[model samples]
Target chain A: MITAAVPERENYLNNAYGIKSWLLTRDHKRIGLLYLFTVTLFFFLGGAFATMIRIELLTPQGNFVSSETYNKLFTMHGVAMIFFFLIPAIPATLGNFFLPMMIGARDLAFPRINLLSWYLLVIGGLFSLFAMLAGGVDTGWTFYTPYSTTYSNSWVIATALGIFISGFSSILTGLNFIVTVHRMRAPGMTWMRMPLFVWSHYATALIQVLGTPVVAVTIILLFCERVFHIGIFDPTLGGDPVLFQHMFWFYSHPAVYIMILPAMGIVSELVSVFSRKPVFGYQFVAYASMAIAVLGFLVWGHHLFVSTQSVYAALVFSFLSYFVAIPSAIKVFNWTATLYKGSISFATPMLYAFGFIGLFTIGGLTGLFVAALGFDVHVTDTYFVVAHFHYIMVGGTIMAYLGGLHYWWPKITGRMYPEGWAKLSALIIFLGFNLTFFPQFILGYLGMPRRYHVYPDEFQVLHVLSTAGASVLAVGYLMPMIYFIWSLRYGKVASANPWGATGLEWQTPSPPPVHNFDVTPIVTHDAYDYSTVIGQEVEVG
Target chain B: MSEHIDSVKTYALVFAALIAATVGTTAVAFVDLGPFSVVVALLIAVCKMLLVALFFMHVRHSTRLTRLVVLGGLLWLLILIALTMGDILTRNWVGVPGR
Candidate 1:
């Protein structure tokens, strides 16, 4: 490890002491840290709800809780994970921390709005908590109609309003990233020369700005239904419930891309860094990110195959869904190619990267199965669908998140976590994750539906296995929480380029100063340009 | 920044036209145009949205990449709505045997 180049240690502990300063801080790094703390808190809350759900499913009866309570449990879990955690987890924390630094800027273009987004998250989060305390809505994350507006006993309006507010937070964040990427890059940091992480985020932000408003309107219409009895989604009043699904998934489906695109970007970086090579097929990988984001919008109807949609429509969506996979396959293959004939290291980030590839491929392929109308009819709400999404959202997104956290810990904290433990946790997470999710796929195919409090006796074996693996998964997740915090105080001082990485963030001091760079260094070479850095184009002031 | 940019006045006029079109569609909703009403409303909404997106969002003046990004969202939205309707419209003619 290289020694940190900070002129003098700025006591990170005393740097911003009061809650007010932290709340009011304009520093992008501080904002990122704030999100890190909040999102982590919500992660466990969501995880606890998930644990409750898995435990309830351990038996074939509604013994652990009533059906209503179980419904609330899963609904809250889905909302908390999607809205509060996954969507913002990586981009908000790591993206906020590093995007400005990587592009050689001091801060995001709109710092006050950056701070505002976090506050919006907290406020929206509180609204959700209040809604839960007031007897939570039992409508699933999709909030399918008739069930949501006409049937559910809980406060649908409050929860829908909370989500509507949070959608603005996402939109604002996307707008800021777009402006920053457009106007804030240092001289010579060309479009291709920027890190793949930024490129992926750029694509994600494009979707967020364009797609999020549609959902906001949809949710507001739902809220109006609850309050004013607006019959847009009310079938008896000549409104169509399927239209709501259309609008919701129109945003929520691409929202999945918003969730995974950044993770793909992270994997691209980690694979190249660990393998010590320029990413193979850089242009294809780059354009494929945009392709996925664009194609992601067209295929939302695939989710509606079993509903009132026509067979011809389902066939079209199935074809589009399969086509979307082509770009995803291209990305996966390029990553594999980048690893070919290269110096591959089993670093912690690289370990997580490999886990992402394996898990995401499984998740994506199964998505194909569900997207096909015939297969979806057999297992629409079954454990298979659950397993399919969990592989992508949890196994794929969360793994890349941990990988990015480890990759950038040195830069953020100026300290390195213990390598052995990091790798151990990565391995445990990989194993525990598969154990928890894989059985659900089989159980689903065996005709076990999800969201039911209990299942048949034969499925109990798998359910118990899933619960046991969840215990292990919890352990794997908690390990990093313990060690990463410990490392901040006592770990070795990290050098400017501990991983010998080539991003501009690495060229600066570890625990970068208030202003990221003392002088902006013009990036005259391609990203991951170890060869150019060593052989030809030098960093210029 | 440039004096030749008196076209700002023209762009403003275009913006007013969008507002008028939007209000016009909403107002004509009361006039019982039958199925044609929905089509007319949506067509006008599309025009206004496009004008704002292209001119006000600066897609027209922006680089090819930005135009591509803007076009991508629109084109796919059309595909989704169109293909969905394609299936719904054809369903009556095909008439599945079970029903």
Candidate 2:
């Protein structure tokens, strides 16, 4: 009934025709679609590399590929996945599309710069892809030096340059978001009136602007060391290798927050909407994001506990690492509290949110295990570390990415994806993900190190089980790809507010017009104010 | 946003002070103040940075948020250097008995 009553008008999708329109368009929504296509391609490319690694690990004998090829496989996997896919996953796509809409703006402050960022990412990705195709860098994604600089050689400079270029893309996007958030909110859309998603992105942008430059500088230093034979990270040339660890993790640590904060923002929206309640302690959740961004910088040393870092420094880092978890926990607790006695839905997005909260908790707790200096001595470089991050990156970020994608699909595409398939895939991903990574925690605790092509026969059973789970996870991922494409033509037409969501984004058309709002909306209610629409069916216009 | 336009006199005065500071840095480098040489050099650099930020960059005339952004960048840099120095400084506090 709601769909029938809604008028169909020319929207972003039908506003133009052909390749030139999309390629040269300055529309934020079109740019978001561009990012969605690019990142999804990289996701599969990264996923292909992951499949190779998993299959190779299916047996302890390392029968599938040579050790060197295996090294390249995992290296490319990490490089493609982290730099290309996960880091830019939500912000470049979802945030770019919706941040302006949610705050009642026509577009981001710098639309051209937004387009440039996507182009930069494409160029950067091409460079990395060229490196992979040429010979593949085998420095593990960290590109730890002396080895990266002096010895173990394979396209290090090319790959680092690729990442360096991509880093600019990230920095530019962050600048755009920061300027837009500061200047573009509609009248009455005060700081407190903004959605938690915007709040989290604002914090993420801070980290992006401040922190990405450090990694870019680090890569530059690495470039100089490798190409110019500088004595920066090479121990034989009087360089302290540990200093590389220091500089690398300095950015890489906050880089973890870069990967997860936007995901947390998505979860904040999902939990509140599905629970039909305003997010509990909204200020705490918002400030918690800022706190995570700030505190995230102080804990980089935790990555160096086993590198013979000083006991005092390690102690300081360990303590601060624990403190960083407090803000994250504050978020988790607030989401849970928001669900108390509230009308909850089992929609696909909310299912993914539940998956994120559970898996991210496990990931965050295991981080404490690795944060301890003594404990890190045992688990550093082991599958425990591998599992811990996958839980966070895959379980936490990917789950939330998928959740946000499903939550906003109606708005982005004006079609409802087959909900039954979405829910089933979410379930498969959760089960298969747990099956794949949970055993790694045990294998790691039992002293199985990572990145090995061969292992003792005793580790074979767990490896088999993990590989089986990876197969299932592969199916889980593929189903969405197939159905999301299929849904474009055949799925149910979506009303503007299919989910009864409460954001300025929902006030417009399903696939909004060229200018998002016909007239700028002045916010009159708090975010996630579902009570007003609870009993009545949501209207499209 | 600042209605106050900086006069040429103010610019010239700051420029003269910077030149003086550069000369002072060169003079200070000639005399070894033992371990404090690096300290004095860094202090002079900080003062020069303040001059540039406050006058040249017009941070002095900027809004509170702009000032906070500048300070925030500086504080983060301090955290990186100080925390890292904590590790480098005390690395061999207990040396292994033999090489």
* A1-541 per-residue lDDT for model 1 (tens digits): 8987776655333466788888889898999999999999989999999999988888888898899899999999999999989998988899899888888888998999998988888888888878988998789888998778777888777778778888888888888898999999999998988888998998888888888888888888887776778898889866878888888888999999999999998999999888889999998999999999888988888888787877777787788898889999999999999999987888899999999999999999999899888889999999999999999998999999999999999888898889989999999999999999999999999998888876789999998889888888999999999999999888888877777778888887788877878799898888887774454321110
Report candidate 1's interface RMSD in Å.
2.2
**lDDT of each residue in A1-541, candidate 2, tens digit only:** 3555666598988889999999999999999999999999999999999999999998889899999999999999999999999989999999999999999999999999999999999999999999999999899999998899988869999999999999999999999999999999999899998999999999999999998888898899998888888898888888888898998898899989999999999999999888889999999999999999999999999988888788888999999999988999999999999999988888999999999999999999999999888899999999999999999999999999999998898899998899899999999999999999999999999999999989999999998889999999999999989888888989888887887888899889888989899999988888878865665454221
Q: What C-alpha lDDT values do all the predictions have? A: 0.87, 0.92
Q: How much is the lDDT of residue A259 in candidate 2?
A: 94
Q: Which stretches of candidate 1 lie over 4 Å from their true place?
A: A1-16, A532-541, B1-30, B40-80, B96-99
Error of 2 at A342 (Å): 1.3
Stretches off by above 4 angstroms in model 2 are A1-8, A535-541, B2-52, B97-99
Error of 2 at B66 (Å): 0.8
Interface DockQ per candidate: 0.49, 0.70
Q: Can you give the lDDT of residue B38 in candidate 1?
A: 88
